[model samples]
Target: MSPRFQCKQRGAIGLMAVGVLAVVLAFTLLVVDTGRLYLEKRKLQGVADTAALEAVSRNGTCLAGLSAATYAGQSVARNHFVVGNGNTLVTQCGAVTTAASGQRTFSANPALSSAIQVVASKTVTTSVAGGIWSLFSGNSVSLNTVLTATAVAAKPTPTLAQLSIKSTLASVDTANASLLNGLFSGFLGGNVSLTVAGWNGLLNTNISLLSYLDQLAINLGVSAGNYTQLLSTNVTASQLVQAAITVLTANGATADVLTALGNLKVAAISQAPLTLGKILQLQTGTTAAALNANLQVFQLIQGVVQLSSNQSAASATLPVSVLGLANITTQIKVIEPPQLSAIGDPALAVANPLGPNAIYVRTAQVRTQVTVSLPVLNSLSGLTTAVNNLVGPLTPVLSGLLSLNLVTTINSTLCLLGAGCQQLDLLVLPGNLPLNIVLDAGGASSYVTAYSCPTGSAGTKSVTAHTTTSLASLNVGNITHAFSSTQPMSVAPMPLVDLGIQTCHKILGIGSCDPRVPFGAGGIAIQVQSNIAGSNSIQDLVFSSTTPFATPPNVGLASTYQAAAPATNLVSGLSTALNGVSITAYQPSGGNPLGALAPTVVALLGSVSAIVTPVVDNLLAPLLNPILNNLLNMLGISLANVNVGANLTCGQTGEAYLVI
Candidate 1:
C-alpha cells in the first residue's frame, strides 16, 4: 500500500515541475522578442534622422518640379533596414502642420520647401506570443509589431554678414510748393497736400532690409530662401507699396504713406535681390543676403516720392521797388510734375541700374511775369497850372498812364531713358516797350556713372560712374554765347533791361503842343557779359551701407554717403552771370529835343539799374541757386558733403537647422 501511494505522489510532483518550467521558458521568449522590437525601433529612428540630414545636405532641386530630396531620403532609409520585412518608407519636401483637431499633417508649403521629412516603418514577426495567442484564441493573430520613425532636416545657405551706409546731404525747403505740387500731381495723377511733419516722417523713417524681404515673402505667400527667393518674386506697384507699408508700420514709422500707397497702380513689377542691391551695384557675390536694416534704397526713394506727392504747389509774395519808384509786391510760383515710374533694378548701372526708377524726376520749370505801373499823370497834373508862368503859354495837357511787363522762365531735364544723363535750358524776355531784351543759360547734356565696394569700407570707395555735361549755351537778344564742355560757364552781352523815352514842345495859344523825338539817346540798356571761357566739372555723390544704431529712432544699419566735391566753377559761373553788369545810354543824331536831356536821364536810369542789381544778384540769383541745388540733391545724384545713415551688411555663409 505505501509503494503505490509514493509512486503517485512522485508523478504528480514531476508534472507540476514540468508545467512551471514551460511557463518560465515562454516568459523568457516574450521578453527577448519585446527587447528585439525596441532595439529595431531605436535603430530605425537613427536611420531616419541620418537619411533626412543626408537628403537636405544635397541640392533640393529636381526635374519636373519634383523633390529630389524625397527620393534621396527614401533610398537612404531603405538601405539602413534592408533585412526587415514589411518595410515601408516615405519622404517629402515639406514641414509638419498641426490642425485644430490636435492632429499632425504634412503640407507642401513653399516657405518650408527646403526642409525634408523622412518616415520609415518595419514589421517585427512575433516568435512565442503569436503561437500562444493562436493556441488560446483558436485563430491566427498578427503578432507582427510595427515600428515607425520620422525626422526632419533642412539645407544650409549663404546670407548677408555686414552692412555700411554711404553719406548723404539733404535739406528741406517748402518755399517752392508749386514745383512740389506739380511733381507730386504728375506722379499721382491728382492733387495732394502734405505737411512739413508728414514729409519729415517719411524722410526720417528707416527700415530693415532683411526684415523687409521676409515681409515681402510672407505677403507673396513664398518662403524666404536665404534671401534668394527675392529674385524669383515680382511685385506690382501696389503690392510693393503694401509691402513697404508693412515694413514701415512694423517699425512704428509715423510717415503718411497712405496717399502714395493708394495712388500707386500696377504700372510696373519689381524683382528682388538685384532690385534690393541696385544702388550699391556689387559685381560679385549672389546678391542674396539676410541682412536687416531700417532703410533701403527703394524704401528711401518711395518715401521721398510719397512726401513730395503729398505736398501742394509752392507760392510766396515778396516786396521790391520798381525803377526806384513806389514799392510793389511780386508773386512767385513753382510747379513740379509727377513721375510715371520710380522703380529700380539692382543689375542695372546708375543709368540703367538693373531697371529704371519708378519715377524720373525733371528740373522744375519756373515762369515769372512782372508788371510795373507809373503815376505819370499825377506829376503832370500839378504842373499844368504853372505853364502860363513860363515864357510860353500852355493849354490843358492830357496825361497818360504807363505800364511795363516782363517775363522769364527756366527749365531742364536729366538722365532720360535710363541713360544716366542730364540736360537744361533757360529763357528770359523783357516787356514789349520799344526795346528787345533776352537772357538764356544752361548746359545741353550730362552723363553720370555710379560706383560700389565689396566690403563697404572707406578705402574701397570709388567713382562708380561719371557724368559729362555738354557745352553750355547762353544768348542775349541777337548775341550768342557758347561754352566748351571743359570750360566754366560764360556768356557775353547778356542784355538785361531797356527803356524808351519821348519828348514834346508846347505851342502858344494852342490847347496842346507836340514835337517829335528821335529814337537815339532816350533809350536805356543794361547787360552783363563774361570773358572767362573754360570747361567745368561736376561730381556726383554716392553712399555706402552703414553700421546699425543702438538707439530707438536710429536703431538699424546705416550707410556712409560721400558726395563729390561740387564744381566750384558751377558756383563761379553763377556768380559770373550776375557780375560784369553795365548800364548804357545812347546819343541821338536827329534834331529831337529829348537828345539834350539824355545825360540827365542816363544818370537817373543808372541809379535805378544800380538798385535793380542788388535785387537780381543778391536776392534772385542766390535764391535760385539754392533751389536748383536742392532739386539736384533730392535726386540722389549729387551731394554737397558726406552723410551717414543706418544700413545692414550682407555676404556671408549661413547654416540651416531643424525647425521641428
Candidate 2:
C-alpha cells in the first residue's frame, strides 16, 4: 500500500474505533443503570412484602384496637430498606391500601380494611454512567433513578359453625299431651295443637349445618360467601315462620308439620339472626348471644323444638294404686338447656374465662316427685277384725287413726362431659339418659360424677358413676287410720289377747275376755336412718358419629375436655326424730277392777313382746317398705347412649380475612 493512503486509512480506522467506543460506553451506561434499577426494585419489593405480611398478621382485622399493626409494618419496612441506610427509601411509610379484583384501592372507609398494601421506593445512584455521559456531553444528566415496589397481603376471615341437631321425637315423651303441647307452643311461638303424629314429624327431622346454611342462604337470596350480610339481616317473626315452612317443605316434611308450622304466630316483630350462644342463653332465660350470629331464626326454632322434644320424652307421669289402701302418683322430668344439650362450647374445651376448672358440659337434670295419700285405719280395721275372728279373740294392735298423706320430691342434676362437636356437620348429641346425678332430698344433697371413656371399638363408650347417701333424719310424717266410732281400733298398737286362762271374766254383762296389753304406739316412725348409698352405672352408651373429628379451617378434634369430681359424701349427719310411736294401754284410764282382774291385767301388760309382732309384721311393714324403696329408686337416674352433634370452632372475634 502507498504511505499516503495507508496514513489516511489509519486515521479513518482510528475515527471508526472512537465512534464504536462511544456507542459501547452508551450501551454500558444503559445496561448498568437498568441492572441497578432491577436490584433496587427487588429489594424494595422484599421490603414491601415483608412489611405487608407482618402488618396483616399483626392486625388481622383493621380496627382501632389493633393500631399497633401500622407501627409493625413501618418498622419492618424500615428494617428492610430506609433512606440514608442504603439505596432504599420508603416514600410512603405506614401506608396501607386494600387490594381486590386485581386492583389496589384506598378510601377513607372502614369497610376496606380487609387487605394491607405497602408501597416502597428506592433511589439508585449511578457513578460510572454519569461519568461516561459527562465525558461525551461535557455535562452530567441526573443518573439517580427512583424505583418503586408494592405488596399486598391479607388473612382470610375466620368461619364459625352452628350446631345441627340430628335426633328423633321418639326420644321425647309424648305421653303427656299437655306437656308436649305446652313445649311446642312455647318454642313455636303459639299453640300449634300438635298431635302425636305432628310431634313425630318435628322430631324426625334432622338437619345438617351445611344444608341448613345453604337453605338459609337461598332463602335470604344471597350467596354463601355473603355470610356477613346474612348475619346482619333482620328476621321478622312472620319470616321465621315462613322460613321454617320452606325448609320443611323442601325437606319433604309431613303434612302435620307443615300445618303446625303454618299455624305459628307472628308476635316478635323483628329479631336478629339466632346464634348458638343465644340459644343457650335463652334456655337459661337470658337473651344474650354466646356465639357468632351465624344462624337464622328458623334454625334457632328448630333447635329449640328438638331440645324440647327430647326433654319432653325424658319426663313422665305415672299413676300408681296400691290395692286401694294407698294411691300414689309420680312425676318425672328431665331438663336440659338447648345449646348445651346439643353441642358443647368450643371455649369450654380450652378454658372458661369466667372461672377455672369449670367443667362445661351438655347437661340434663332429673326431677321427680311421688304424691301419696292414705286413708285413716278405719278401712284397715277390717283386717284386724277378720284376723281377730280367725284367731278367736287374738285381736291385733289398734290405736288412734286419721287421714294421712305425704309428698316426697327428689331432684337430680346430671351432666355429660367431653362431647365431640364439629363445624358445619350434623350433631347427634348422645342420648345419655342420665350420666351423673346430684340427688337432693329435703335439705340434704349428694353429687355423683360419672367417668366415661371411649372404648377400643369404634363408636362405643362407657360410663360409671358412684355416690353415697346417708340420711340420718328423714322426716316421714306420722300416719293415721280411722275405724268405726262405736268400734274404734288401730293395728299400730296391740289389741286384747287371751293367754289360755280357763277363768273368764264378764264386764257389764258383755262377753267374757282375757286381759290384753296395748303397746305404746301412735305410729311407727323412723327417726334417724343410715344405709350404704349404692353406685349406679350404665355401659356402652354407644354413639356412632359420621362426622366426629374436624380438619383445618375448622378446629380439629378437640384434645381438651372438661371433667369434674363427683360428690362422695351425699347425706351425712342426718338426725332423725321420729314422732307418734309408743306402746300404751288401749283400755280406758279407769275400768272394772277386781282382785283376780289385777293379776290378769298385769300379765296382759307383760305381753308387750307380741304387741309389735302382729301389727308390724302383718300390716304396715309389707305395705310401707316397698313404697319407700320405690320412692328412693325414683330419685336416681342412670344415663347411657351418648351422641355427639356438630362441632364449631369459632375463631377469635373480629378476625379479618383476605379479600384480594
Worst 10 residues of 2 by lDDT: 421-430
lDDT per residue for candidate 2 within 1-660, as digits (tens), equals 899999999999999999999999978978986687676677677776776666666653344455434654565546755545334423121223334565644332232334565666666675565657676897756666566776665555332222222111233334433344543444333444656665555555543333444455567675432334544454444564566677658778778767656655342222423433322321121111122123323334544443442333233343343212244444433333333322223333224312332212233333333333333232444433432332221222110111112111111111112321111111111111111111222211111122222234553222211212222112121212211223432223222222111123444576453342222111111111222132212221111233243221222222111112222322222111111223333232233211222333334433442443344334433343332333322222112112222333333344333232
Q: Write down the TM-score of every candidate.
A: 0.43, 0.36
lDDT of 1 at 26: 74
Q: What is the lDDT of candidate 2?
A: 0.36
Deviation in Å, model 1, residue 512 alpha carbon: 30
Off by over 4 Å in 2: 1-37, 53-61, 76-184, 187-189, 192-359, 366-395, 399-638, 644-660
lDDT of 1 by residue, 1-660 (tens): 699999999999999999999888878878897778778888888877777776666645322344555655565647666634687767676544446797756554343445677777887776566667677998776667678888776654332222232213232346433343343444444444555444444455556654566677777776554344453444443455567677767666643544433434332222211133222222232322223244543334443343233232333323342112233333222223212111122223354533332112222222222222223211333222321121111001100101112111112222223222222121112232211112221221111234334553443322232322222222222222121223443323322322222232234544332232223323434454442222234443333323233211111234333323443465566566555445555454465332444555455554545544544455335333533354333433232332222122222235545544
Error of 1 at 413 (Å): 45
